[model samples]
Target: MDITDNLAAVRRKKLSRRAFNRTLLSAGVGMVATPLIGTRQVVAQETEQGTIFTWGGYDVGELYTSYEAANGALPNFAIFGGTEEALTKMRGGFTPDIAHPCNAGLKRWVDTGMFQPIDTSRLSNWGDVIPELVAMDGNDAGDGQPWLAPFDWGGTSITYRTDLFELEEEESWDMLWDKRYAGQLGSLASGGDAWWCGAIKAGVPFGEIATDEAFEKISAAMREQRPLIRVYTDDTTTLEQALSSGEMAAAMTWNSSAVALASEGIPVRFARPKEGALTWVCGLMVHKDAPNLDKAYEIIDSLLSVEAGKFMINDYGYGHSNAKSFDQFDAQTLVGLGLSKDPGDILSAGHFMIPQSQEWETRMNETFEMIKAGF
Candidate 1:
C-alpha cells in the first residue's frame, strides 16, 4: 500500500494513546496548525515559563528529564513539521523561546535576526559536546559566540529491502533510477533531499547546485526519475512499513529507518552509495525576543545531556552531539547502524548540505513540487 493508504489503516486501527502519540511524534507531525498568513496570539503566557518550537518527538518527557526534575513541570511545547514552516511562523510573529533547525538552515535562520547566541558557559555539559559540531558552518557569528547547539546528526541514503534488491557492484545512487525497479522505487518528498540526490546522479557537485546549468541538469534528472517512484513521503514510518511488507524494493531514507526496520527483523540495508551519503546536523536556537531566557538555556543543556544523548542514539538511531554518547554502544553495533565512533568522520565523508539563499531555496522547492505534481 502507498503512504496514504497506510495512514488510513493507522486511523482505522484506533491505536492506544501511547501508540498514537508515538506515531504522531515519530512522523514529526506538527501539533499545532495555523495558516502562513495573519497573526495569532502566542500560546503560552507566563514570562518565566518557556515554550519550545521543535519537531514532535523532542518534546517527550524523557528528553527533558533534567529540566522537569528541576522545574517540577515540563515546559510548554509547540511542534513544527520542517525548518521552513517554523521560520515562516516565526516571521509571522510566533515567539517560541526555542526553535530547532538543521545546520544547513543555520545561515538562513541567522539571517532573519530572530535568534540569540547561546551562552555556552551556562551549559554544564557544554565541555563534552563534539567541538567540530559546535563549529559547523553557520554556528558561529563574527563576534565568536555560537547561535545553534548541535543536537542530532545523521546520513541520508538509500534504504532498501535486501531480499528484493541485490547490489551487483558498488552500491550507487543510480540504484534509485534503475529501470528494473521503476515501479517499486520510492523517495523522500522534500526537495532538500530528492534534489541533492538527483544532483549526485547528474554528477553535479554540491558546490555547483546554485548555477543555472547545474539547476537544469538536476531538474531534468529528477523529472526523469519521478515516474519511477511509487510514493514520495517524508514519513519514514510509512516507508519502513512498505519496505517491511515487501511493497517497495527501495527508497531514499535516513539511517533511522534502516535501523528501525532491521531491529524488527526486516531484510533491510542502509546503502553506502558510491557518491557518498548526504549528512546533516540539527540543533536548538534561542529566540532573539525570548521571554524566558533562563528556562530556554536549561532546555538546551538538558537536550545535550548524556542521558538525552543516550535516548537520541538508542531510541532514534541518530548520532548525538555529545562524544560520550558513542560509549553507549559497541564498535560493531555502531558499524551496523552506519555510524562511526567519531561523528566528525561521518560529516567529513559525506556532503554536508550548505546553506543557500532564500530565493534559491524558494525556487527549488517550487520546481520540485511542480515535478512531483507530474508537470
Candidate 2:
C-alpha cells in the first residue's frame, strides 16, 4: 500500500479493539516475560544487546562500541530517512528495540501504540535531560509512563552558496522562491519537512494552521516554485554534490548538512530568515513489545550521557538538548554546533516540529502530491 493507504490502515487499526487488545496483550506478555520488567521475577538489569533505529550521523557506531566495552553489550543500529518512513516501517511490522523520531511525530507513534513506556526511574541521567524535550503527552507511555529519551535537535534553515549569492545583498526567504535562480534550487523530498518549508515560504505558521485552505495555499506556492527546483532529495550527500557543482545555487536545508557542506570550502551559508525555520527535535523511544528493554535503556543512557552529547555536538554540528553538554565541550566546539553558553537565544528563535492532527496531515500530503504531479 502507498503511504496514504498505509496511514488510513493505521487509523483504522488504532480504532479497532481487536488490534488494540492484541497489542495490549502482547505488551503485557512482553513486559512480564522480558528482562525489562522490574518485577521480582524478571531480571530487570541484565546485560544484553539491543537494536536501535535512527537517522544517519546520529549514531556514531564507535560510541555504541565504547558503551559495549564498558557495559558488556552494544546496540545494533539501523538508519532511516525520516520519521514518516520510520513509522511506516513500524506499522509494517519492522521491529527494533528503539526508534528515533522527532518530538512532533511522537503523537502518531504513541497513538498507534508503536512504543513502550520508559522506565524513567531506572535511567541514570533522566533527570539531567532538558525537561522541555520530554514535555509532551507521548513522552510517557499510553499508560502514564515515560516512553522516550530525548536527543539532539536542529533546524531547517536556508542554505545558500555565499559565493553564489551575495550575502549583504541577498538575505531573505525570497532566495528560495527567486525566479532568478530558476532550475537551480533544491528542497527536502520527504512530505512532512518539504511541506513545512512550503508553508513557511507561503507565510503559514509552522505550528498552527489546521485547515485545508492553508494546505492548498502552501501547495500552490510550492507548485509555483516547482519549475525552479533542481532536485527534491533526502540525501545530504546529494545536496552537497548539488551545492558544490552549482546544480543548486540555493536550497532549504538542515543546519548540520549546510555546515558540513560549507566547511568543505563549498561556499555555502545557513540563514534563519525573518519567516523563521521548520525545526525538529529527535529522540530515542523503545517499542512496548521490544524483546530487549533493559538493553534499550542502556542504549538510551549511553547516547544521552553528557559524553555522547558532546561527541554529537563537536563532531556533527547538531545542537543537543542536554544542557550540560556545553560544560563538557569547549567554546570553539559549541560555536561550531550553533550552541550558545546561554541557550535562551536558541530557544527563542527555534520552532518545534509539532504533530498536526492526522486529518490535516492527510490533506497536506494530498495537496503536496497534487503540486508535485503538476510539476
Candidate 3:
C-alpha cells in the first residue's frame, strides 16, 4: 500500500476504536475477536454519519456488520413501529437518508413521491439478490432498476408458547381469539400486521380487502380481539420477552420472535395457522431528499450482503434477499425454521398482502388505531 494511505489509516485509528476497525476493513483485514463494546448495541445507539429509518428489530449490529466493518460506525437510526407510521412521518417532512417499508405498502410509499429509484449497479452485491424479491409487486423503477432494495422477507404468524397455549384444533388463527387466553394474548399495535391478520380471521379476501365491506369486517374482528389482547406493541423485543417470561401465552408475531424465543430455550412455536399466515417482503428505499445519498447506498449495500443475510437467517430467522444466504443452511434446517430453499414454498402457502391505495392505508391505520385505543 502507498505511504499516503498508510498514514491516513493511522490518522483514522487515532480517532476512536471504531475508526480503527474501519481502517482494518479498508485494508482487507478482519479482527479475529470483536471488541467487548457490544457492536450490535452500538447499532441501537447511533452515529452521525447517516441515518436508516427502519422497524425496531432491524437496528441490530449483526444485520449491519458489513456496514460497521467498512464505515467504522453504524448509521444513525430512527425507529418506527410500522410502515404506516414511517410513511406518515416522512410525508409530514421528516426525511431520513433511507427508509424501510414492506412490499404491501410499496404502491402507497411510491405514490407519495418521497422516494427515489435505487440504482442496483451502485450496490456491489446487487447481482446476488433474489429476483422474485427484487421484482416485488410494484418495485420496478423502469430499465431494470427498483424503487426499494429488497432486504428481508418472511411471514407474520402467531408465535405461541407451546407449554402454556393449548391447541384444540389444527393450529388455527382462532388461537389468538380462543377466549381462554383473553388478557393473555399480545398483538402488534400497527395495522400493517394486526389488521391483515384480523382480515384472515375475519375471512375477508385479500382481493376485496380494500372494499368498504371488507373494512367493516376486518375492523369488527380487530375490535373483538382488542379486549382480549394483553398488550399491543410493534416492539419485537416486547413480544419476545413476554413469550419468554410466560407473561403472554401467545402473540401474533413475525418468525423472528419465535426464533429468538427458542434460542433462549423458551418452548415456543411459530404457528402455521389453518387460515394461512400473512406473508411479506420488506426492503429499503432512498429518500428523494436524502441528506446523505452516497452513504444511503452504502448502507443498503451492507444490508444486502451475505454476512448480513446470514445473521438475519440464523439469528432473526428471516429470509434474506440475497439468494446465497440460504446456502449457509441445509434444506432440513431451513424447513425447521419455517423457511425453504425455494422462497415460493413458504410464500405460496401464506397470503401475500395485496397492495392498497394511500386512501386504504390512511383508513386502515386510523381505524386500527381507534380499535387499539378501545374506541
Candidate 4:
C-alpha cells in the first residue's frame, strides 16, 4: 500500500490502552503496548494529538511521520532556538503538549509544577534506553515525581573551521577567547549554556563556580573576546551559513551541528578541548496539565524504540540513549556519528551541564548581559 493508504489503516486500528499489543507490525503500527513484566492495569488512554515543542535538530521529522504511520495522526511540532526560548514561550502561556529541555534546566521547569511524572510502564521501549541516560540527573518534583524522559543526548563542543585554525597547538577551550581570532568567534546568545563555556574558559569548576565573583571573572573573559566574535547566534542554520562563507572561524557550538556541517563538507571539526567541552543532555517532558497524556506517552514510546533510535543516530548525527540502537551501527557509521562502539569511551571526556539554583541562573544572566554590553 501507499503511504496514504498505510496511514488510513493505522487510523482504523483504534488506539486503546489495553489493545495496543494485539496490533500487527505492518506499516509502522507495530508497537507493543503490553504491561510491564510483572505489572497490572491498562496503561492509559490515548488522548488527542499533541503539539510538541523542542529545539531545532532535536527531534527529526521521521519521528512524526513514524508516529502518524503507527497511530494514524500526527503530533503538531514547534521548534525553538534554545531551551530559554521554549521556556519563555511557556511562561507566556504558549502551552505545548510536550516540551524538550536539558537536564540542567529541569529544576526551573519542575518549580513551576507544570509537569507530570512519566508513566514508564506505558513506555514499551523504556528498557531500550542506555542505563547511563536513564540514570542521568534530573529535577524531581518536591513530591518526588520525575519530570523528564530523555531522548537525544550529546555535548556542546567547540566547532572551528579546520581549514582556517590548526587544531594541534590550539586544541583547547582557549581558542574560544583567542585574541588572534577576535570578532570571528561564535556562541549562542542564551546565557544558560554560554555562561558555562565562559566559566570553563576561566578555569572555574563546572559545578562549583557559580558565585558572583566567579561570574564576574567569567564575564570579563567573555568581554575580552568580544573583539573576536562576529555573531552571538543560537540558530544552527544561521551559524552554519556564516561558517560556510567564512564569516566565522570558530565558535562554541553544539557537537551535532558541527558534525552535520562537516558532513556537508564545511571543513569544521569538534574538539574535546583542554578543559573538556561542556556536555548537555536533553529529553522530552510532558506538561503538568497536558491535555493528551496517553498520546504524548505514545510519542515518547516511539522515540524510545530501537528503530527510531537508529534513524536518530543515522540521520540526525546524535548519540541516542537507547543502548541497543548502537548495536545496529558499524565501525564507520559510529565514527561518522562521532560516537564510540564502547559507551564508556563515548562519555569519557564529556561532562554534564551543572544544574544550578534559580538565584544562580539570574546571577549568570546578569553577568552575561554585562559581558555582552562590553562591561
Best by TM-score: 1
Q: Candidate 2 regions off by >4 Å?
A: 1-48, 71-73, 137-145, 167-170, 330-336
* Candidate 1 clashes between residue pairs 3 or more apart in a chain or in different chains: none
| Model 1 per-residue lDDT tens digits across residues 1-375 | 323344565779955666667667856644344332223344324444678999767778888889989898888888887668888899999898999888767888999999889888899888899998888876786466799988889888999988899777888998999888888899989787888788888999888889999889988999999989999997777888889988899999888888889889988999999898888888889999998889999999889998998887887778999999899889887888888787777888888788787888888899999999998
Query: In angstroms, what RMSD does candidate 3 have relative to the true structure?
Result: 12.5
- Give the poorly placed runs of model 3, Cα more than 4 Å off: 1-48
The runs of at least 3 residues in candidate 1 whose Cα sits more than 4 Å from the true structure, single-residue gaps closed, are: 1-49
TM-score of candidate 1 relative to the true fold: 0.86
> Which structure is stronger by TM-score: 3 or 4?
3
Alpha carbon deviation, residue 252, candidate 1 (Å): 1.2
* lDDT on C-alpha atoms for all candidate structures: 0.85, 0.73, 0.87, 0.73
Clashes of 2: 5
TM-score against truth, every candidate: 0.86, 0.81, 0.83, 0.81
Error of 1 at 102 (Å): 0.8
For candidate 2, write residues 1-375 as lDDT tens digits.
Answer: 212333465767753656557667967998778764455433333224687888887666644644686666556667889766777888898788888877667777777777777878877777778876677545765454566677877778788887776554546677888888898889888777888777777887765666667766887888888888888888888887888888888887787777788678777777767777666777888888888777787888878777777766666667776788778777775666566665556655766566766677667777777777774
Cα lDDT over the full model 1: 0.85
Clashing pairs in 4: 114-288, 115-288, 182-228, 183-227, 183-228, 183-229, 184-228
Top-lDDT structure, candidate number: 3
Residues 1-375 of candidate 4 have per-residue lDDT tens digits of: 322343455598745533344334441442333335223332232234677887765455576655777768777677887656677788888777788877778777777667788877778877766666656555443353356777887677788898987555857888887777777788877887788887788877776777767876887788887767888866777777777778888887776677678778888878778777776667888987777777788778777777777877777667777888889999787876667676656676766676677787777777787777777
The true-structure Cα RMSD of candidate 1 reads 13.2
Descending-TM-score candidate ranking: 1, 3, 4, 2
